[model samples]
Target: MVRENPTASLASLASGQSFALTGGTVILEDGSQSASDIIVGADGRVVAVEPFLDTSSCGACVDIAGMLVTPGFLDAHQHLDKTGVLRFTPNPSGTLQGAREAFAKYARTAGPDDIHKRATRTVERCLSRGTTAIRSHINVDKDAGFHGIETLAGVRDAEKDRITLQLVAFMTPHPGQDFDWLGKNIDGAVALADAVGGTPAVSEDPPRYLDILFSAAVKAGKPVDLHLDEHLNAGVHLLDAALDRVERFDMRGRTVFSHISVLSALPRRDFQRIAQRMLDLDVGAVTLPAANLYLQGRDYEMLPPRGLTRVAELHRMGVTIATASDNIQDPFVPTGSGDMLEIARWTLLAGHLRGDELSAAHHMITTAPARLMGLGKDYGLKAGARADFVVTDCIDTDTLVAGGPDRAFVFSKGRLVSQTATETIREKEDA
Candidate 1:
């Protein structure tokens, strides 16, 4: 199923031959190059990047005369399987509690085929949006049953080469439970996943949950990711506890806290202290603006808070922060098309990240997320790097973000895998 007006796919590249992209703006990590041509070899690695290249003996050539080319976007965090829940349930309240109830009900009623169909559609939509990499969290809790795991595995296989899907088996263990059984199941799931996930503060007590997850993470030798401190309550200050475990087990930088929403609730002094600790401990923060904002604060009405991590403070403290869309069309967040441009726009508005912060936010969806996923080194269209990237309509970072996703001429490993129409109607109306 190849797309119409497809770019050169990585598979089409033959050794010793070069494919040239005629004209587009190429955005590098540090700067942007206009009217550039990117050449790729048969080995699927970028052979050369210059303003002009001699085009000869190439297996295929794509003349994207009027487009903007940049590194393929990466959704650092998402929930593909749970997105299927949206087809049946509408979380009108849009609270965490409402989401929990809706997901529980929908998971029971939904089967693997249903999940497969929806997840596949979601992934395809993501790819069509020029998102080539996604770190998806799959629910492994009992409530989701086999449907979550089965759906996740199918998605992983179906979109493996086209899109990089790093699966994190997510679950929340009960407190005072038999540790052995919990560890066994979690470890078994880790054996089948790229990483391990837990929701330390999502449970009753943050301390106990962190302890269990940290112990399991240490034992399994897997990078730990906890849905830490998602509430606006300062009482659920699990960041310190999680760092304590990271120090105890020496996991350090390998641990990431997703949606540290309670970070903003901490007093400035306390926040600074924890930020320094996280910096020293090498822990990272993953902020899920889409789902966190939607799921938190069912009890509040006026001035509902942005349930996201303290991104500015974290950056000031030298901690790495990345924005993610945790749930797309799921109970947690009823709508998302796996578009990080949308996420960036929302982040810019909600987080008040402007100018340099905007630049950093742009990196958050591209290089920053890719590096966090441990796959960005070869991600861009640089010499010796894999020819996996996208061509968009906007020329500069500001325009790119403002323009949203206009078109998705995506190439994976130098082969044309998918393409999507940019919302040109919006562009027309804006004009």
Candidate 2:
């Protein structure tokens, strides 16, 4: 039985100081929850995770009985540059093309200060909800003209102490501009960002667009994250083309495909074939259910299909898959709170995952995305890993992933960065 300790206080630990959190249920890498004590070293790395630890030498010891401790959530795919613009730019049609046009108009006049302020607010909201790291795709095109990349890089540096922000120079296509413009600007944007990304499906020539993106990533020694085949037209899909480029550029284990919703329209055999190729190439996939479900299947009047990729099938095929909040309160999504657990829940329902697979859903927001972001062994709740964790009142992984807890404590490198608790009031009625 788990014990309840409502009076337990979470003390902040500075850098170069050791701390211990005891009597908590920790979610391990293998999707199991165990009662353990997490010992954070003086260097802000986990020294040990055992059933009990010697806290005599630690500077602070906190008892967190009946709480669930897990690695901080990782949002592998997001659009920080386009977030929080619902008031100014609303997608009246609620379609993908409408959103693109809306955001393009907004970007034409948006300054660096506007982009920085909006992105910084989103980062704070994400951190308060237990997201320690985010991989945001900022638009890099003729309309935006590198403003998003320059502004977000500053935000990444400013928020380095509280959150880890990875920027992807999203090479977007615009009218009246040819591939030459993208080619000339991609290298410079990739130099300033952590990865190279683009929306190949929206380009006039998908193959050529993908080639430019892959070449830039290869030249810069960076990973490629692409918005691949987001529509439901399987006949006009580009997954195979992207896979061919993945092999041609030798980007194995360094390429991620986001929002390949076309997979939902393919037959089982065809999807299996593509899945096998992805596994062989060590390519990763991310499903943006929030944006896809809202933006796709709008033309169909009845029995509209869920616009997510084949998440359960991909997992069965042993493909490294993750889910993320693609857009937040913007024209693309128009609804999001920067909460990763909410994203996990959407994946659980829209991805057709069973109730028993809640642990797998939890991994979509944690370990799966971490691996896609190339965090490999540096993340998680293991010894020698960075001491980034989220403590919640939920007792197990299922409870945590279902809807999340009302109270949460976020720690980055063993330092308490954000904490939230919701209070409820009820009226008593006379019987």
Q: For this target, which candidate reaches the highest lDDT against the unseen true structure?
A: 2
Residue-wise lDDT of candidate 2 within 1-431, one digit each (tens)? 11244323673445567888888899998888899999998887888999978878888778888888999999999999999999999889999999999999999999999999999999999998999999999999988998999999999998887788999999998665588888788899999999999888778888888889999999999999999999999788989999999999999999999999999999889999999999999999999999999999999999998999999999878999999999999999989999999999999899999999898999999999999998877789999888889999897999999878988889888888888888899899999
Worst 10 residues of 2 by lDDT: 1-10
For model 1, residues 1-431, the per-residue Cα lDDT tens digits are: 12334333423444355578766678886645567788888777788877778877666666666677888888888877777567577777877767777776777777888878888888888887778888877777656644676668767887676778888877654435444555557766776667778777556556665666666667777777777777899865667777888898898778788888888888988888888888898887888888877777667779777777787677656687778888887778877877788898887777767666666777778876766677746777678877778776565677778666556667777767675663434345654
User: What is candidate 1's local distance difference test score?
Assistant: 0.74
List candidate 2 segments past 4 Å from native: 1-8, 11-16, 426-431
Scored by TM-score, the top model is 2
**TM-scores, all models, native as reference:** 0.87, 0.96
For model 2 the TM-score comes to 0.96
Every model's Cα RMSD, please? Answer: 4.5, 2.2
